[model samples]
Target: MKKVLIVGGVAGGASTATRLRRLNENLEIVLLEKGQHVSFANCGLPYHISGVIENRESLLVQTPEKLKKRFNIDVRINSEVISVDSSNKKVVIRNNGEEYTETFDYLVLAPGAKPLVPPIEGIHGNNIYTLRNVTDLDKIMEKLKEKSIKDAIVIGGGFIGIEAAENLQEKGVNTTIIEAAPSILVPFDSEISNLLEVELMSNGVNLLTNNKVIKFEEKNERVVISLENGNKVEGDMVILAIGVTPDTNFLKNSGINLGERGHILVNDSLETNIKDIYALGDAILVKHFVTGQDVSIALAGPANRQGRIVADNIMKKGKTYKGSFGTSVIKVFSLTGASTGLNERSIKVLGKKYEKMYLHPNDHANYYPGATPISIKLLYEKESKKVLGAQAVGVKGADKFIDVIATVLKFRGTIEDLSELDLAYAPPYSSAKSPVNMSGFIGENIEDNLVEQIFVENLKDFDKDKNIILDVREEFEVVVGQFEHSINIPLGQLRERYNELPKDKEIWAYCAVGLRGYIAYRFLTSLGYKVKNIAGGFKSKLKI
Candidate 1:
């Protein structure tokens, strides 16, 4: 029987072992986990620390005993793979004080990732924590129990940092998030991030942007964070959620090829450079489906998929990895934020030509009492009209909208496909047309030359020039607010007052939402006038 050895036993490794056993019942599978728990919910660590998950045993998805009894797989805990000799197909395993070599015909490397602990002075001192594994969570829980952690400082404004801040605040801890970047959740567009900032701040969580944590200072049994901007923050405990890197140091001399960032290099089949060796999960570099470039994505969804693919390939099945969409979602207070495919910032980095559209629509029918507006941004290739990516942020159903867009991206669906999607809708659940469909409607119009538009970023360039900025809302709507140098001409009276608009220069049209502006754009464009509809209309202006 062929022996299959899997290193690490969380999402990637455990899933691979279980699937491998199910595929080849006679194969000898040995799973090694350096930690105590083999299969546990690592993502729920923050919640556990906040006492939301009252029972620590709730995090354990599966125990070694359960796996061994059910799948007949040998799961060894507290066992570490110190070294790998791929030439001889042997791995040096360390258990207790003894060392042994295990030879395998096929090896799967899923060592996962380690928290990036910077070389800051006093970083190793007590009260500083890095949340990566079960042990880290245990340490945090112990610390919280010992001290009244009123002030908590979280470094990094990524998903983990935001979640940690929210959970800590739920426990009545005064949480502060410090990010070196200018904004939180850099994966999101700045406008959506602005909404997140407001929400986080309103929840009593202090957000410090463009601030760097230089080092830690131990003072009076508390840790003080020293910042680059000459600001010091004292916290009862510090959580470093900066980022993570692939755990590949154990393979430095194992004749394995590593990518630029020390991630294992694997092909579409998850096969490494060495023969009969495979690498999956955060430790491997996979292709970005949109850009067709190799990138490292540390996400559980991709990791789980990679594990299944590896199992299929191991069983002589012709399963191929189609690359990752980098789809991700997170909850912050009341808002649910999610993104898929690519964003405007990523497009800029890749130097790709694309067009973007923004739409603000209720998550469900407006008549439904709890319905909230969902702000969606869609980016598509201008020439092909292909859906490249999308982002949505709102209180309810944000993830669902992003999910639809992600599915469209997977099938390489065009903007026209979005409008034609026959999605189920009802009064309490959704409108006649979903927000995703509305985005497609707007995108198709832009692609078909039916609507000429300008984005918020391009507003400054056009603002300096002499142009007729027309606000198509009602007089009362403008009474509440309007942009500078804008002429208010309600859409109801636009046809009657057609002669009032200047015909020499271009006229930029806007309304409360984008629907009215689109109507006005169609009207003015047909009338032999240079007209451009402002994407997202006045609602976008308010956000900016």
Candidate 2:
């Protein structure tokens, strides 16, 4: 039997080991983890801070003894792989203050990633913490138990940062998020992430965007963070949820190809530069599904899938991993935001000619109790009409639409494919024309030249002299808000008021949430007047 040595144990390593055993029970497998626990739910670590996941023991999904009994594989905790000797197929591991050598016929490196704690002044203070595993969660939980632990400063506004802030608020701590980027949740466009920001502010989580922490000082037993703008924030505890880096330091001199950021570069078969050596998980570079560029997605779903593919390749089954779309979702206090594939920022960087459409539709039938509007944005190639990506935000069902779009992205489907999907529908669950279908209908309108729409970002560049901003929403809706210098011509009265509008100047129309503006666009276009509907309308324009 060929001995296989696997380093690390989590979504990637743990799944690969179990699948390998199931595929071929004759192989000898050894799993090594630097940490004490194996296969723990790292994603649920933030929830435990608020007692949302009350039982701490539940996070540990597997044990060494269990894996030994089930798969007859050797499991070693507290065993850290310090270096790889690929020429001899041996690894140097440090455990219990001792080092040992392990030989393998096939070596797999799945050492995931570590929290990136930047070097800032006073960062090593006891109150500053970075959560990556159960050990990190324990340290944070201990800090939260202090009676005077009232304020927490989360240093980033990515997924982990926002999740930590929401959970910290739930634990009765006044949480503040400090983001260096212009907006939080950079994966979603500003329009979608703005909804999450609103939810966070409404729940008393302070957000500081376009700011960076220059230094950290310990003052009065609290962490004092000095910002680039000369503002100072004091918090009983600080969480450095900035990001993560690939944990491949051990393989730096191992003759295996590594990316500039230290990510293991593997072929589609997941094999490294050296023969019989493989790498997977968050520590490896993967091709992006949309752009086809090597990128670091660092998502658990893709890691788990890559593990299975790597296992099959090792078994000579020859499976290939296409790529990752970076599909992910986040829960704020009361709202959820989800996205898949590329966003506008990325598309522009690639210089791809793309079109975006937005729709604000009720998640379910309006007559159904508790129905709420969901903002959906879809991006597609202008000529091919191929669905590039999608984002959704709402009190509920945001993940559903993104999941559908992600599946479509996997198959490289088009906007028309989204509209034709036979989705299940019930009054309380979804409308007859689901939000996903609505996006497809809107896309068809754009493709057929039945409608021309402009996004909220385009308003600043519109020529005020030659363009008229028309508000087609009902008169009462203006109380919420309207564009400056925009004239009110409700969709109902657009026909009668047509003579009042200029035929030479372009009409830029808007409504509360775009449906009425779309109607106005169609009515005005038929009369041979140049018109453009404000995509997503006034609602999307608010608070941005």
Top candidate on TM-score is: 2
Q: Find the candidate with the highest lDDT and give its number.
A: 2
Tens-digit lDDT string for candidate 1 (1-544): 9999999998999999999988889999999987888998889988987788989999999999999999999999998999999999999998897999999999999999999888988888889898888888898888877656688999999888899889989988889999999888867888777778889999999999999988898999899999999989999999999999998888999999997779999989999998789989989999999888998889999989989999988898978888998899988888888999888899999887899988889989998888899888889998888999988889988899999988998899999999999998998888998897888888878877899888666677665355888899999888877777888889999999988987888898899778999999999888998988888887776344
Model 2 CA deviation exceeding 4 Å by range? 462-464, 542-544
Per-residue lDDT over 150-195 for candidate 2, one digit per residue giving the tens place of the 0 to 100 score:
9999999999999999999999999999999989998998878888
In terms of lDDT, the poorest run of 10 residues in model 1 is 457-466
* Model 1 ranges with Cα > 4 A deviation: 462-465, 542-544
lDDT of 2 at 248: 92
Question: What are the TM-scores, per candidate, against the unseen true structure?
Answer: 0.96, 0.98
lDDT of 1: 0.88
